[model samples]
Target: MKRSIATLFILFSITIVKAQEIDSLSFIKSKRMSDDDLAKKREGTFFTGIPDFSSDPVTGFGFGLRTNTYWNGNRDNPLFPYTPYLAKLKANAAYYTSNARELVLSLDVPYYKGTRWRFKIDFKAQQNPANLYFGLTESTLGQLRLPSDENTTFSTYREFDRARKTLRPGGVGEADFVTDALSNRFRETEYMLNLKADYALGNGKWRIMGGYEIQHLSYTTFEGMEAEAIDPITGQNTTAPNGISLLRRDFEDGLISGVDGGWVSIIQTALIFDTRDFEPDPTKGYYFEIANEYSSKYIGSQFDFNKLFIQGRAYQKLPIGKRTVLAGRFGAGNIFGNNAPFFEFQDQWSPEGSINALGGRQSLRGYRANRFLARSMWFTNVELRVRLAETQIGKQRFAFAVAPFFDAGTVRDRWQDLNFKNIKTSYGGGLRIAWNQSTILSFDYGHSKEDRLFYFGIGQAF
Candidate 1:
C-alpha cells in the first residue's frame, strides 16, 4: 500500500473479475474517440462479486472476495470518453498465509456529477507480519556479506556467542554480538485513511490537487538471543535462541525512533499538467507534476516534516513500427526538517500518490522493496512496448504487448549529498495484457546485483 493502487495484490483478483481503472495515476484524457468506437461502448452499472486468490513473494498466498461496482452512466455524459470510469466503489476482506491481513474500502469519482472536480476516499487496516528493514541507504547493501567469512553461518556465530555468554556470566569480557539477514524481519500493523480532491483548469488539461492522509503505524521488533540455564532434571538447555533484529538495534542505538508508533497526519498539494492519450496504458503525450506535503503538530501529526517531489513521464509512438511505443519517467524527491519519521524516507509522494522509492517493483524493480531509504533520492525508468496481437472477445477488446525496460536510481542521507555515483540499476522485460482499454495485467522479472524479483501487477508501473 506504500505505492500506487497497482502495487496492491488485491488488484490481481479484481482485474480478473472485472476491468476498470480509477485511481490517482489515471484521470486525464488526450485523444478523442471516433463515433463508431463510442457507439460500441457499454453504459450503466457493472457489478461483480467473486472469490479472489493471489500469490506473491511479499504477501505469500491470499484468498478473499471483493465487491466491485462501476457506474459509467450514458455515453452522452461529458466525462464518459475522458474518464476511465464515471465512478467506482470497491471493498475487500482478505488474509495471507504469512499471517498478513487486510480490510479495505475505496471510492473514486472523476468529473463529479458534471462538475470539474474529482474525489477519492480510501480506508485500510493492514498487517504485515513479514515487514522488512535493511538498515537504510547504501550501507544496507554491505550487510549482505555479513559474517565476513564464507565458512561462518549465522547459526554457528549465534551458538558460539551463546556459549561465550554462558561461560562468562555477566563479565564485560564477552564478545559483541552480530546479526544476519534474518534480523531484518519485523511486524507492522497500520490503519490508514486518505481523502483526495482535484479540480481541473479551463481546458481540463491542468489540475490543482489537494489531499489529507493519516496513518497509525505500530511495529514489533525481534526478540534477541538470550542465555538460559540448563534443565536440572533433563540436563539440557530449555530455552530457544533468538538474535536481535536490526530494527531493535537501531532503536537502542538511537538511530531511529517511534518504535511504538504514533500518528502521521499530512496535508498535500500539487500542480499537475497531463496530456496522455490514455490514462491506463498511455501511448502518447507527456505528464508533469510538482507536489508538496507538510506534516506538523498543528495538523495532529506526532512527527513533523516537509517533502517535495517533482516528476515527469512521456510516451511516444515509435514511427519505426505499428503499435510500438517508447515510455519514460524521471523523478526526484527530498524531505526537509529534522523531525521527519524514518518511514517517510522510504516513500516519494505526488498527486498520483506515494511510490516506494529507490527500489521495489514500482521503482527499481530488481532490488527488494524499500531496499534503500534516505532523505533524498532520484530515479528514472525507460521501456519499449510493442504490441503483438489484438482480438475481440465477445464484445470486449483485448490486446497483448511485450515491454523491455531499464531502471536506475540512487539515494543520499541528505539532499546536499545527492550524486549519481553509486547508482543502482535493474534490467528486465514484461508481458502486458490490456483488457477493455482500461485494465492491464502486467508480469515482469527483474535482476540486480543483490536480488532477482518477479512482479505481477495490475496496470502500468508509472
Candidate 2:
C-alpha cells in the first residue's frame, strides 16, 4: 500500500510538471492574441475537474472525481464588481472499491444581492460498508484485555503482542483473534443536510450566522464473521452460538446501545469576525467566531444537547516572500444537557462547521475520524504555506503550494478536567493546488505517536 501511494504521488508530481510545461508553450503560442481579445474571453463561468486519491485506515486507497464551478452571480450586470459576491458549486464523489462510498454536494452564494448576507447549503450521503471502531472512551483497551491482565496499561503495539501470547489452546493467533473478536468494523449509513445564512455587520468584517441541520444515521454489523466465545472453565476461545456476531456482543454489552440510529435536528447560531483576504487560502487577517447549538425533542430531535463553541484563527503574510504565509487556528467545544448522543460528539457540529474539536482530517490528521470523544474538547493547528509555483493555463489561474503543519489536541469527559499533558500531537506537511483562487485541492501526510496517515481532500483543514 505504501509503495502504491508513493508511486501515485510521483505520477501526480510528474503530471503537474508536464502541465506547467504545456501551459508555458500555450502561453507562447497565444502571444499573437491582443489584450482586448484576452479580456473578452474571460467573462464566462470557470470549471475545474481534478482526480481525487485519498487513503486512511478506515477506507484504504480510494479514487474518485471532484468538480468545482465558479461564476459571478452578477455576470449579467457588467457594472457590478466581480468578487465578494461570487457563486460556487461543488460536487465530489468517491468509492473505495469494496470498502466505502461517499457523495457530497454544496453550494455557496456570497454577498447575495449586493447585500451583506450570504447563504450556503450542503448535502452529504455516505455508505461505509465496513467502518472501524475501537470500542469507546478509555475503556477500549481495558475491554480487550489482550496484551496483559484487565488492569494492565500498555501501548497498542503491546496489546497486540499480548493477544498473540495468549492465543486460545486451539484458537487463532493474536492477529486473527483481534480481527475476529474485535472486527470492530461495521456498516454505517449517514445522510446530512446543512443550511446556513450569514449577515455581515458594519464593516463587513463581522457577521451574524444561523443554520439548521438534519441528520439521519444508521448502522449494522458486517457479515461473514464467526462469533467467538470464551470457554468458562479453560478460559479458551471458541465459537459462539449461531446468529451471534461481534457487533451483537457489543450491543449486548450495552456499549453503543443508546443512540445507535436516530434523527438529529440542530439549530445553531454564531457571531463571526473575519478579515482574511481570501476564504479558500487566506494570506492575512484574523477570523474569530463564537457559536451555540441546541438540539432537543422540542426542536424535533430524537436526542437532546446544548453545545457551546468558540474558535479563532490568524493568518499572516510573511515578509520572506510574496507567497509565504503563516496560519493558525484554535478552537474548543462543550456539550451540555443530559444524555448527549454519541454521534453528536463528532467534530463536525461546532462553530463554522469547518473547525473540528479533535481528530480526523480536519483536526488531528494523524488520527482516525472520531478517534476521541468526550463532553468537551479543544484543538489547535499551525501551518506555514509556501507557494512553489503559479501560472496561467488558458484563461484560468493556478497556484501550487506546500505547507508544513503542527496539530495538537485532547478531549476531556468534563470541561473542568482539561489538561495540556494529555494532548495528542501530530506533525505533517501538505501539497495544495489552487484554481482561480476559489477552489483548492489538498494532499497531506501526518504522523502521530500511534500512526501515520495520508489524506486527500478539498479546501484547507481549518
Candidate 3:
C-alpha cells in the first residue's frame, strides 16, 4: 500500500505541475504591473491559484483546482489594523481519477472587530463513489476459523466460506486481512454547515466561543464491484466472487449501527486560553481549550448524546534559530449516551471541527482515516519545525519549512477499558510552504508497523 501510494503521489505531482502552467500567463501579467498597482493588489483583493494534489486510501489519485481570494478587512474598515484584519475565502474542487469527487467552500474571518471576535463558516459536499469500511472497533486484526459442518445453517455456512476465501493466507481474500484490507465499496453523500463565533476576553488572552453544526449523511452500496467478474461454471450472475459483497452486506444487516446515516445537529460552547503571537504558524505561546457538545431530541438530532473534549498545545522557539520551534499537542474525547451513533464516535470530531484526535492527516499521520475509533480516545503529538528558506514573488512572501514529528494514541470501547500499553505510534517528517503569513501547503509521509501513509493538504497539521 505504501509503495503504490508513493507512486500515485509522484504521478499526481507531475500532473499538477502541468496543470499550473495553464495559470502562468496570469501570474506573469500580475508580476508586470506598476508598483502602485502591485501594492494595491496586495492590500486589496487578489487571486491566486494553487496546485491541488491529494491522495488517501479511499481516493486513489486526486488533482484539481484551489483558488484563494485574499484581502484585508482594514480595506473595509480603516480603523482596524491590517495585520489582524487579513481574511481569506477559498474554493476547492477536485476529482479522484479513480472514483471520487469533492467540492468545498470556506470563509475565514480570524479578526472581526480588531481581534475582539473571530468567525468561520464551511460548506462541503462530497460524493465518494467507492469508500472503504472496516468493522467498528479498535482492532481490524482477527483470527479466522472454518465453520463446523454439523447442523450449520446455510447463512452460517456461506459466512464461513466467505471468510475462508477472504481471510485465507495469500489468497484473494488475504488482502482484506492486510492493513489495507477490511474494506467495502460504498457511495457516500454528505452536506455539512458549521458556524462559530469567538469573543475575546481580558485583554484578548482568553476567549469564549459558541458554535452550531448541522450535517446530513447518506450512504449506499456502490455498483460495479462485480463488473469484471465472470461465473466459472455457468458464466452468469457473478455474485459470490465479489469481494465487496461481504462488507456491503454486513452494513445492510446493521452490523454497525447508523451505517445508513441520517441527520445530526449539535450545539457547543467552550473556553479558550491563547497567547500565541501568530495564529497561522504559532511561534511561542500556549493554547488550551475545553469544550462540551450536546445533541438531544429537542435539537433535531437522530441520536441523543453528550460529548466532552479537551485539547492543549504549546510552542517554544528553539535557541538555535528564530525560525526553529518545538510544538506539542494533547487531546482527548469521550461520548456518553445510551447508544451513540458509530460515526460520531470517530476521532476526527471535537467542539471545533478543525481539531483532530487520533487519525487522518492532522492527527496520526501513519494510519488510515478513522482507522481507530471507540467511545473514548486520547492522542498526543510533538513536532520540531525549522524554517529553511524565505522568498518573495509578486508581492507575496513564501516560507519553506521542514517538520519532524511523533504521534501516539489509543482508543477503547469504554473509558475503563483503555490500556496505555496498547497505544499505536507513528513517526514522520513533512515539508511545508507558507503563503503570505497565513495560508499553508503541506506534504507529509508517515510510517508505522502496519503501513505507511502520504498526505498533501492545506494548513498546519495541528
Candidate 4:
C-alpha cells in the first residue's frame, strides 16, 4: 500500500522530530507540580502489561495478553475531583489471524463507593472464524462490485476477487480460478457471549444499563462449495447449487434467521447522559444516550426482538492549542421484533458504549468490520485532539497527542428504511499516549472508499 503509506509517513516524521528531544529532560516537576499536582501525587495502584502485537484489517495478526489496572482512590476521596479511576480494570486475550478469538473482562467503578452509584462490568468471548456476510439490505451496497458480466459464478467472481483484490489472484489480469475454491460464500462462523451492566442515576450524569447477550452461529454452505454447471438438458457437467453461500442463500431464501446454529438470548437497557470531563480522555463534556433491547422466548431468547438506540457525544476545548480538543459523535438505531437474529442486525447501543455500525474500528473508520448490515443504522464521528508533548517517568505520566478524523454512516432495512442513502466515509490520523493520566494508547489511521485501516486500540474512537 505504497510501502505502507511511506512507512507511516516516516513514522510521523519521527514523531515530529522527537518532540523536543523527548520533552527536553523530561520535565522535573515543571517548577514543582501542578498537572493537578502531578495528578495528586500519583494516588495509588497502577499497573499495565503489554505484549499485544497487532495488525488488523479485521483480525489478522493480534497475538495476546493486555492488561490495565488503575485505582487512584484517596487524594482525600470525594471521587478525587470527579473520577477517572477510583477503580478500573481491563483484561484482554487475543488470537486473530482470521481464526479470530478473543476474551475480555472489564470493570469500572465510577462514583461507586463515593455515592451516586456508577458501576460497570463487561465480559466477552468471541470466536469469529472469518465471520462476515455481505448481505442484509441496501442491496448490500450493490454486492460491492466486480461482476460486470460473467452472468455471475466463478464462485461469484472469485469471492468478489477476495474482497476487492489488488493483484495476487493467480497473477496476471486475474479472475480465472474456476471450480469453486475459496467460497465460504462471504464466510460465516461466530460464537459470542457478552455481559454488561451499569447503574448511576441521581446526578452521576444519569445512567442505567443492563445486559446479557449470546450468539452462536455457524454455516458452511456445501463441503468445498461445489460448482460445475452446464446441464440445461443433461448434456454434460452438473453440480452447482447456485454455488452456495450468502449464508447459504440467506438460509435458502428465507432471508436469514439462525442458519443451522442457534442461541440468541439477549436483554439490555440504557438511559445515560454523561458529562464527560474525563471518562478516560475527554477534554470537555456532554454525552447522551438511550438504549433498549430485549429478546424473548421469555428471556432465554431463541429469537424475538426489540431494540432502540440514540446517541450523542461532544467534547470541546479547541481555542487554538495548549492541548486542543474537539470531539463529536452521533447515532441512531432500530430493530423492533419479528425475529431478530441476523447477528442481531449488526449492533449499536449505548450506556456510554456499544458499537458495530456502518463499519469497523468504532464506526466507519476505513470500513470492514461488520461492514454494514441492516434493520436501521446511523453514525458519525469527528475528531481533533492535540497536545504534543509532556513527560515524566518514575511516577509515570506521559502525554502526546494528535488526532484528525471524520467518519460517516448509513444503513437500513426497515425503520422505514431511513434514507440518508449510501453515505459511508472515512478519513483519519491519530496517535495518543497518556499512560498514567489513566491509560489511553490509540494509534488509528483510517481512509476509506473501501479500506485503508490501521488501528491499535485502547480508547478514544468514542
Q: What C-alpha lDDT do the candidate models reach, one value each?
A: 0.71, 0.66, 0.63, 0.65
lDDT of 2 by residue, 245-321 (tens): 34455566675444367888887777778776566677677888877777778778887777777889998878876
**lDDT tens string, model 1, 344-420?**
77789876657988677789988777777777889999999998988887766778999999999888877887778
Model 1: CA > 4 A from native: 1-41, 48-55, 65-68, 141-181, 224-240, 320-322
Please list all clashing residue pairs in model 3, or write none if there are none.
166-173
Give the total clashing residue pairs for model 1: 1
Clash pairs detected, candidate 4: none
In model 3, where do residues sit more than 4 Å from their true spots?
1-42, 73-84, 140-182, 222-224, 227-255, 355-357
What C-alpha lDDT does candidate 2 achieve relative to the native structure? 0.66
Question: Arrange candidates by lDDT, highest first: which order?
Answer: 1, 2, 4, 3
lDDT score, candidate 4, position 366: 82
The TM-score obtained by model 2 is 0.77
What is the full ranking by TM-score, best candidate first? Answer: 1, 2, 3, 4
Root-mean-square deviation per candidate: 9.2, 12.9, 13.4, 20.9
- Candidates 2 and 3: which is better by TM-score? 2
**Higher-ranked by lDDT: 1 or 4:** 1
The window of 10 residues in a row where model 1 has the poorest summed lDDT is 165-174
The estimated TM-scores of all candidates read 0.80, 0.77, 0.75, 0.30
